[model samples]
Target: MPKAYSYLRFSTPEQAEGDSYRRQMAAALDWCKRKGVELDDKLRFHDLGKSGYTGANFTEGALGRFVDAVQAGEIERGSYLLIESWDRFSRQNAMTSTARLFDLATAGITVVTVDDGQEYSQERLTGPDVSPMLLLVVKLSQAHLESARKSNNVGKAWADKRERARAGEHKLTKRAPEWLSLEDGRFIERADRVEIVRRVFRETIDGYGRRTIVHRLNEEGIPNFRAGENRKRKPTGWHASSVAKILTNRAVIGDFFPGTGSTRFRTYQKEAEPIRGYYPAILDEDTYWRAQAVIASRRRVTDDDGRVVQRGAAGRRGSGVSHLLTGLGRCSICHGPMHIINKGPLPRGGLYFECDTARRRAGCDNMNRWRVDEIERRLLKHLTYIDADAILRGEASHGEFEKVESVKARLADAEKRRKNRAAMLEAVEDMDPDSLARYRELVADVTALKAELAGAEKALAQTAADPGLKARLAEAVDLNRAMGEAEGEERTAIRVRLAEQLRQLVEMVDFHPELSIIAHLKPRADVPADQVPFTYDSGNWRLELSSDSEPHGIDPDIFPEEDPDAVRAANAFFLKRRLAKAGGAS
Candidate 1:
């Protein structure tokens, strides 16, 4: 005749899996059937693994949800709430329990305590002053006390367990860190996971960023640290944030903060002191801290929203500026990084690559800025002057076909020298009247000659087989085309690509007063960028353009003087640098 909603609750997972849930459900169902009340399964609400002592059930529990709906008039005023007992409705404090019951009764809905066989309604609860429901209040009060007692017992048991852990009886709880295995009341490093942690830290120290490491790990299909292996679940993958956590975790260093402290049940450990020697360390303290230092160093200065703002030229490549030479340009005098600054009405190649030192008030006499279009145009003309395309074509054929023979000849000569030296070294020894020092020197020379011969032979073999020349020639041809033929976005993309390529090719470009460019050639091979010996050898060439004596201070596009020889030298430098990078130049 009446609509009755069933409320099912399980305080613990064990209870959910046990007969308690079935018994509670059966009681509610049987009571409804006896009363001939229609009970729809849709109206059955379940809140499992929730504690009765906490009022979180009201906010998060199914019974509390039904009560909430009844109070909010979502349920009809005459609907019934069927619970196993008053205690099942709530095990809150005496006052709170009584207040909630009164509120429920006042809302004109009936609360059926099936186990206790008690029914509370608005009419029965009506009294002039207090709505004298002595029996219900007493029952609720008993339930509240029982909940408090059980909560204290649970807290005591937790304290006992933590004390046992503190007294070296067992680990703090059931499980330890994933990298650690709890064996016989002690934590030992899990070998496989330990290796994973070591790799993470090592990768971090090697300058691989967290996100990059994550991508690499995912690419390699390396599974992450997961507990439920052998259980039927999807495999978890690595993430940047998770990698970051692994990097920052101190537990990998074999120190574990057990988090055993003075607090209530399930509370945060306040004064945590890590217990060292709990497990074998995956990484030493020095390596761990070194990684931490680098990680700290890379953390950029961020705005309120965590977006990095460029303060100085520390790590800023000036991605905001779309100019081709923004990152590659360098101040000739001060050696500070050059940033792109747009001046004039703009788009007439008005973009200026100026030194950041002068702008930052780090007073420098060379406050000169180079124009983008002027530099690009000069650069192109310089490439044409050197006939770089022809040099590339010639170099390609010579490296592939011609140079191998010469390298072989040199290699043969070196091997002959090595053999002669080795023979001399063998003949000498202690038996000869010559000094031991002389014999040792001969041995060293033979060793050197042998190494040199090997290098020459390798070089000859590489020259004969290397296929890198075509790509280098193609890149150079593309640069020439972008400078001479292309326009608009196509030209811009090529220019930017060329700029990036040149960045890897040339070390830094130094601007002179007359729009003259001097790119202090950065080495392209194993040669270091700074110590690019000032040489005219095509293999390790440096660029130096002639400058007008005084500053012209006119438009950058306007050439101070048409020096064809200077242009050829500069273009040769560019082509040589590119070839050096391509590993096709001898």
Candidate 2:
């Protein structure tokens, strides 16, 4: 008996939950049973949510695979291809759909529309029966026309909605940012989600990196806003990318853009310009821009000669901050990054920070190394005791915005120059060599100035939005306390947080040839210039040892009343039993 393969396709995924799947499958099975052919249950072809009108089912879907298999002889020539209707195979243009049908028939594969019970075999298609071929052409053409009309109507509907939204008639669909909800045709902030959004921005502006924010959110058991919405898989906990999206979304500052894509895919191929003040504001403009600037700064750090001193893969900072000072310290001799090199394992063989150049054996023989555990502990302890409010914020001057003002001035000057050049060109009536050169120079200057202005403004906004040095130091002190109390993976996460904080706070850590480290702190808007670079050295700072080094416990009693051999055997037996129990529990 010949095998019959059933092909089912639905233009939308929602139809899978309806009767389309069952109706099509049942028709195919019934046709196979009546015709005395075996239905091949193993090879199931389903193209869910793929558009037949766009020929997606043929080009990028399972139908295409089936056709290829038939042509390659992997599927036997005399088998049958079963579909509920011709439209289920394709709603494409008549010529294309006709060619597809004839190709399958010519290859000795019978095309069966189970709904109409039409068997379009090779003999029927190639024989002198004009009615069969004309009927197929008519059906395909009708399907194509119907799909085209529907696509047009849907596109127009969405376009009208976008226009109405622009005119402020109503909110653009029920979908809003994860922090918002739709109610009464307007968007309202969800309290819990809005708080999470605020926390993401606050932490970012406070110099906590995205990974640190992810760790903190997951540790606190905050529900992920998108967890329930994803249909493809089970919910994953908070991720760094999710935190980054929250921090950078312009929707938080009330900006919205409506766009359109292909009728089938629904992704944005053409996005309209953003409409300012469209959504309800969740964060101030300053906070949003500051988060952007801080996120940019954390991406990469460059040295004085314009060489990138620290960067991880995929244009992102390494999520793993294993060493306390990874990406924070540099070689005093060559100005290269310092990294931790492990000698072997624990107590005797330890980890030490080695200069990158020295480690590569390229140049700069600064063989001095600092033991990781001792330095980290000492540095953390010193950070906890510092009087940040008195030293950093008390007499601080607010000059960060001056940079923005300077950039604006330069941009204005460039625009004036461009306008004057245009006036001169109009007066001249003909383009000379110097005039053309001057016009080009003016255009170049304006373009460069505009880019610089954007950067300056963003940096200034970030500076203004930041919570200042005092707050950051207080956070560091708290983190230190937490880290001191935490162990295992929790301790590692705290270290990552501290490392990100230190990278933002401290300008550079210089490992000298004298076996000492000098940390130069970055200047802040709230700190006085005379009080900075806030230079400090390991030699000047001393680590105060903690007295609670060990837990209180009594010494073991050596004397026993039972026979020594029997006692030893019983103790060994119980120890083995306890070990077995522990393994089982794990």
Pick by TM-score: which candidate is best?
Answer: 2
Candidate 2 lDDT for residue 472:
34
Model 2 clashing-pair count: 1
Model 1, residue pairs in steric clash: none
TM-score of each: 0.50, 0.61
lDDT (Cα, tens digit) per residue for candidate 2, span 105-157: 88889999999999899999888988998998899999999999998998889
lDDT of each: 0.58, 0.67
Candidate 1: 10-residue stretch with minimal lDDT: 549-558
- After best superposition, candidate 2 residue 575: deviation in angstroms? 73
lDDT of 1 by residue, 251-272 (tens): 7776655543233334346222
Which candidate's lDDT is highest?
A: 2
Candidate 2 stretches with Cα past 4 Å from truth are: 215-242, 259-272, 300-310, 313-325, 328-337, 341-351, 355-586
